[model samples]
Target chain A: MTYSIIARCPHTGRFGVGTTTFSLACGRRNESLRPNVGISKSQAFYLRRIDPFVLNLLAQGYTPAHIARLLEEDDPDFEYRQFGIIDRENNVFAYTGPRIGQWAGQRVGPYYAAYGNGLAGPETVEGIVAGFMSDPDAPLEERLLRGIEGGRDAGGQRFKGQRRPERSAWLRVVDRLDWPRIDLRVDMHDRTVAELRRIFEEFKRCDAYYQECSRDPRNAKPEEVVMSELSAA
Target chain B: MTFSVIARCPRSGRFGIGSASYTMAIGAHCDGAVRPNVGVTVTQSAPLLRNNRLALNLLAQGFTPQQALRVLAENDAHYDYRQIAIVDREGAAVAHTGTHVRQACGQRVGGGFVAVGSMLANDKVLDALVAGFESQSRADLEDRLLNALEAGRDAGGLKGSKGPLPERSVALLVWGKHDYSDIDLRVDLQDGAIAALRRMYVDYKPTAEYYEERARHPRNAIPAMEFADMLKNKQKAMS
Candidate 1:
């Protein structure tokens, strides 16, 4: 019922997660991020605590693979959960428990992991990887968006003949700052991926402006003024 | 950058606001306070968050929507940059769209509802919104509000350099007899925000009663997961 990509952007040192699900508030529940550290996503039969715990382990200098082993060793309901982790070093690890429904699996790449449970097929995960790898030089936000869009295009979560709408989607990216560079969510939408794309386009226009505002409020132009300038240009 | 509808439902005595904006976090900045059994207010364009609370406070003090708008207009320094709409408990509606707001900005006052927009593609957006709401007079308040938002979008929402601008955020809020909102779905920083809001409303509608029951009588309420499974099975059977 969920698909996701957790990645580290080598170019900008940003950690990001892109995810979609046939559930509500996937953005709020599935992923956790720590700037200058790592990112983790715990889905499938999501336990809200797993993401924070994984981040804690990363903070304690544990590798993603080591944390995965610990989870398998300790968690009683390990078979029902799925996890994807990416560290600041760009090391990636992913796990899909056996009890997660059919069409579930994971793909670990150089700096990212694409994974899903109750998907249409393996193509969904493959598409996510291909999209991420399609443009290595692109900004992390764009690549994350493309990855989820790829998953959507390749037929996202499904159970047999019943295709589930991607009801919720989120894109979160954090830099060195305490706040996220981008935290966009479509909590519930029949076409979550497309809606995400639309907002991304709009947000991109002001993305830099907001960063400027945060850094130098005295010198920053008003949002409306900046928007009008863009429109005129 | 924004368009909204504030309305009171005569059938259920609920108050709701549906709004979309070409800005991030419209739910937090544009949507006003919705006090159950009191009134609802939305302040857009160059919105000041404090105005929402102040309007609600005035409404709670038995001030009419029009009177509340006048007070807000007088106290606000950037009055010309604001667009506000209010719907009170008695079904009276009032709105103010300042002259300094962008082109195609206006407000429409109708029976128990006020529709307003700024930086819109055209003035027809408000007309379509009102028409959509009026067409669904017999439906639930949420349905009517959502329909109006969709209609506004169809009529060309915010103005853009090329054409109609895509909405980045949207929210649907409704306050019933309870102190808390009955439905408060938001799609913050997303395009096709209105559509997303509608989808949320659809998904949440069936669960609303369950949530209320759990809140009021937790011991008698079934486990949420079990209830969800039951609903899923019922949906499967129906399909």
Candidate 2:
């Protein structure tokens, strides 16, 4: 039902997360952030408290493995939930519920990993994970696209299992390390995974145009108008 | 708890959405992109992923915005708590407001785009938002969303407040064929009651600096900040 990828660009020193689910758009429902500490989580499939609590634990100097232990220790019913973490130290951690589907599995990367269940097929989840790891040296955008393609090619939840056509979302975040961070999401849409891939491939360019929009005088005050409007009053 | 913006690029026929909510950053909870149709969505608050994903699917299949939204909303789980607005590839618009929303919840349907919000005050504030968008016609959807938010503030905002309603945030998104190169803004915070909302709106306005360098997604993609150069340049020229 879900597939997610969290990563760090050791070369760019940037990080990102990309995901899509057969159940719902996880990006629209989850949130996480840390200042060179670690990325946290509060996803819809799991309790919202997990997001901040994990980050808080890391902020308090808990390693990724320790934080995972803490969450598991506190929840007692850890198998019923799912979680993944990647700290600045690149220590990765994850947990999958016992009730997950056959397609569900977790992938551990040097900086991140992918976990999913209720997916279209076994190969489907594997495809997403393989795509991410296939090019460990690729840009975050390309890597994410490959992962999503992996899901789609392996027959992502499209018309399979015959569920209520659940929804899913994508999220990508990084440290803003001089280079800008990639933060994108989609809420409640069909073919969302495909769309997520397409968006990322193009954002690199469009983001530039938006950069120029801010400097245009039209965005300024009346007299300060950088460019005069041709439309008459 | 959430604030966001959606817009289309006349030059490329691309549509986008971006938002920010209380403690929930814009990129994380309410944002996505569809390349084939050149569309993006900024879903916030409860973040209705099913409906949002369904709507996009319908759009890909050539359904009009209105029909797509209707079909998607018919079976939504938390339909009563969701608010949505969409801009089709052709610039047609559609919007929906769930039943159990707050007072100020509403949407302003424009010619090719729409602005929607939830968990607010009375109808006047909503109407004022439309007025604000209209007044800022020269501005792109991002600014129009901001204008609508300003209108929301002008109409006493969240409540008929003597001061500001400090419980909100804002996000702005713009999508296009340029793909990863779109301009979006996702301001995650503010301090006062309206703290979150204001901080989101103002912080992203710098929009330019993000362009000279590379802007990432989930950090700026959900909100479309990377392509800042396009909006400022194109919209400014058109204006």
Candidate 3:
């Protein structure tokens, strides 16, 4: 019922998660992130409580593969879940449980993990990887959003000949700050991927202003002024 | 730094809040609390997360909006810097704007809704918000709330040193009978936050009922792609 890509940018060291699902609030439930540490995603019967534990394991110097093994050993419902981990060093690992659902699969690439359950076919995960790899020089957030869009284009979730819409979508990126650099969610929408992209494009226009606001509040111009300047330019 | 409207749909019994601010993450920071069948509240202008929870707790205990406001006023030491609005399940709405809040700060109460703001461009902002909401009394709760926020923004949202400030963040949250929200969309950091929020709402509107149907009656619910195909076929036949 869900498809996602978790990756760390080699250029900026930023970690991000881009995801869409047939249910509601996939953004709030599936992802866990620690700035400068790593990113983790748990789906396919996702337990929201496990995300923090995954982050903690990453903080403890556990590799992505090691963390998956530990989860398989410790969690009783591990067989029902799919996990993805990408550390700050761009080390990546992904796991798809056998009993998760039909058309479930995962694809691992350098610094990224693309995975899904109840998808239309293996092409969904393949599209995600191709999208992410298509632009190594772009910002991590853009690449992640594009990756999920590629999944949607390749045919999203499907079960028993009935295709489900990607109703909820989210994009979360964290830099070195305690807070996320970009955190956007479409909790419920027909065009989840498109809506996420629209907002991301809008946010990108003033992304610099926000960064300045966080870094130096006193000297930062109001967002309106910055926008006007950008438009004039 | 912010302006918002918290409302309940008398027709559908849904609670919704729409907010826009010059600051980042207004949805996470300024959004107070919303409980299904209880009430909705928003606290801004030096907001405190605990106050939002407290207000919701009080409303859940069957307190009126005004009474909840009084409790928040009495317990909060920095009440003078805070602005709060609450709408109960009964459609009774109330708001408090402290005297120490920034210039152009005020609030307006209409039937089933409360519009509040601090550091606004002018007093017209709240009035426009109220007018926009009341104009769409027959619309969905989410639509009405978004209309109010858009009207507020058009009337000049935040008051900057020279002119109207740009909204960096905006959010819309609507809750039906379910424990989860029917819609929870946020433009956490954007210059045209209200516009982005409106786009999200428009995109989400068509699928709202589908999700509800899926949750309530999974056996009868049509798959989203199949549903889209059906609609396309219907359109083709009509054409």
Best by TM-score: 3
In angstroms, give how far residue A203 of model 1 lies from its true place: 1.3
lDDT of 1 at B175: 75
- Write one digit per residue (lDDT tens) for candidate 3, span A177-228: 5556677777656787998887778677766775554333445554556766
Chain A TM-score values for every predicted structure, listed in order:
0.93, 0.79, 0.90
Which parts of model 3 are misplaced by more than 4 Å?
Answer: A5-18, A21-102, A106-115, A118-168, A171-183, A186-233, B30-32, B74-77, B212-223, B229-239
Worst 10 residues of 1 chain A by lDDT: A211-220
For residues A104-208, write the lDDT of model 2, one tens digit per residue: 567676776776665665676678787777887887767876776676676665333443233445656556431225665543346666655555544553444
Q: Report, to 2 decimal places, the DockQ of model 2.
A: 0.03
Q: Summarize candidate 3's per-residue lDDT along B185-215 as a digit string, tens digits.
A: 7776567878877765655566556644543
The parts of candidate 1 lying over 4 Å away from their true place are A212-233, B1-22, B26-185, B189-202, B205-239
Selected candidate, larger TM-score, 2 vs 3: 3
lDDT assessment of candidate 3 = 0.78
TM-score of 1: 0.58
Instruction: Estimate candidate 1's alpha-carbon lDDT, on a 0 to 1 scale.
Output: 0.79
